[model samples]
Target: MKEERLFSLRNPWFVVSAGGTALIAILSILVGFVWLPSVHSDFTANGLWGAICSAAGAPSSWYKGGDNVADAPPSNVVVLPPLGIARVNAVSSGRGATLATQRCSMCHGVQSPAGVTAPFLAGQYADVIYKELRDFQSGARQNAIMQPIIASLSDQDMHDVAEYYSSQSRVVQATAADGHDDSVARVLSMQGAPIRNIAPCAACHGVLDRKGAAPWLGGQSAPYLATQLRSFAAGNRHNDIDEQMRNVARQLRPEEIDSLAKYYAAQP
Candidate 1:
């Protein structure tokens, strides 16, 4: 009687098959963990054209005349996993305060007003700074896009660092609507032609948020202000609730953009 042999994995043929399968599986996992991100990002960029084409009811992949990689950062340099803008759990706890004071204060002055563009870090909440620093590393927060610089910090280090900054007081902006007049007031008051059916910039950000994290506008540098506006217009900067900038920026002429920049840069 011929007995049916069990499919023994120990057989040479079976060993080779099993080994090949194992190797391929491992390589696949390695690629997923390490390689595929760059590929996917580039592909998604290309796919954007297809999306734009559909938006315009066209068959071609081109959108608005051509493809724009202008705002897209080099994904190859970005890290994966926690690679997104997110708020940290909490700020400086028991022992982390010292680190924050020594490190963070160097950039942002130790005083209440802090440095020129940097906000005062006296009594602000820790979570806000944590989120911001994390956002800088994760590429979620696009304002600075300080990627490699922030990515250098460990998770625990980030927590301590964010906690320290959060503990500092963020500068509060005061509006004296009647005091003086400039392009700041012009844009905020809607003194010029209506832009994108949008009203003045002051109409929204004029008031402070009890929620925290509303960036102070009046004291921010003109270049910073212009960069933020352009980012909003280009859709590179999202996450704002009302899309205040996107609408406003799209409506601005080049000279008007420069005008706003010059005006805000001169504010006290």
Candidate 2:
């Protein structure tokens, strides 16, 4: 009998094991590098090498000349960390209150009566209010009603008004009568759908972690909130810095939007 080497190709078991391992490696590479990245809308594959490079966290392949370039910044406002931290002074708050009563009361005031869909301004972050006013003034946010009103507001006036709103208490309103449908909204708010790249609503909306300039959603009207979500999803509202809201909104289902809106509206 001839002595046989354990690692030799002549060994049937060795041959089978090696072939199986090779097949698995090939399948993994195909799935991880090609199939996974191809599913995202933004993926730009230059070729096999490009796909591999992107999947491996490497720079674009040398063959990629101008195929997959990033778009320009989407927002005009540059939100700084220190923004919205200013305490409300009596003088500024008083001026802001006067402006709110005279100019903003028609839509935003509590006494506007029922069936109104406009967002309540009370308890909103000052930075959020100021940035939105600036966007309205700059034509970055389009609204026939708001544009003309904001156009005449000076920078100081915007600041005063924002501070005033921030100082006011959140509107005291009735919570949603139905708690059965709210569980979906609560789940979305607390635990986001990671597969869809949607972060938890609480991350930016002040439940878990608050991003700068992100507004407080508690006590807002359900109709107003739902309308805004629809606008964001439809690309009608794109003023959110870095396309953050737009991206999240686009991934949300219509039912999810309704649920989220109702959930926030019910909060105190």
Candidate 3:
């Protein structure tokens, strides 16, 4: 009996198999670690090691809080403490009412009439309004109209304005007369597409569980809702924490987005 060296390159089968495996590994490393991360602006500055780590799905902000970048300019608003529950007193509400009447009423009030797509501020959650205002002021969320309007408002003024609008009555439209079938939208809202990593809309937007700063979508304008969904899908609006709404919007089809908007608009 003769003993043979299994790893010997002289063996044609062994050489072919080993060479193929090495080639595959080299290609995989180049594509995954080099090519993929180079396209992303955030990871490009970090160089080769950053690309390798990102490809492995490591969290990118782990080292970002260091003292080196501390003096660097802030990329986004710091949303903490201010987003907490705001107290609505008579004085605050009065001041808020004055501000809203002077600054916000032209678009959001009853005098503006129907067919207007700017979001109805009446009966909105104070926290939701405040967060959005803060985002607009800090440039985390951009709007030509909102940014300038929110620019002059101080922190207390925003809080007051949010409180005032929240105290007003929500306008409830005749959803039954609208004659739009929304069974699919109802399903999407109540029980999200778990397979696609989408959470139920009600989990955050009020019903099952209300996460912090999540707004109630019921009674919102259909056009506004649809536009916002499209914006999120296109990555134009991304103030949502951890890209939650962005992920869901990206998964929805065009028809589904329209249906969901109509469904929520019809809610009492």
Best by TM-score: 2
Q: In terms of lDDT, which candidate is strongest?
A: 2
Quantify all predictions' global Cα lDDT against the true fold: 0.52, 0.77, 0.77
- Candidates ranked, most accurate by TM-score first: 2, 3, 1
Comparing 1 with 2 on TM-score, the higher-scoring candidate is 2
Residue 182 miss distance in model 1 (angstroms): 0.8
- In model 3, which regions exceed 4 Å deviation? 1-87, 110-115, 174-179
Query: How far off is residue 261 in model 2, in Å?
Result: 1.0
lDDT of 2 by residue, 42-100 (tens): 34324556655656778554555868765434568865544444545889889999999
* Residue range with the least summed lDDT across 10 consecutive positions in model 3: 70-79
How many clashing pairs does model 3 include? 0
Model 2: residues with Cα > 4 Å off, grouped in runs? 1-10, 22-73, 81-88, 110-115, 175-181
Better of 2 and 3 by TM-score: 2
The residue-level lDDT of candidate 2 at 252 comes to 85
**Per-residue lDDT over 1-268 for candidate 3, one digit per residue giving the tens place of the 0 to 100 score:** 9766788988888999999999999999787667755664334445666555656667545774546532222224433433445565899999998999888888888322244478887888878888889888888777899888878998899999988888878886664325566877888899986634567899988889887777888887888899999988988887887777888898787988999999888776
Among all windows of ten consecutive residues in candidate 2, which has the lowest summed lDDT?
Answer: 40-49
TM for candidate 3 is 0.68
- Please write out the lDDT profile of model 1 over residues 145-165, one tens digit for every residue: 246556677777766665555
Superposing every Cα of model 2 onto the true structure, what RMSD results?
6.7
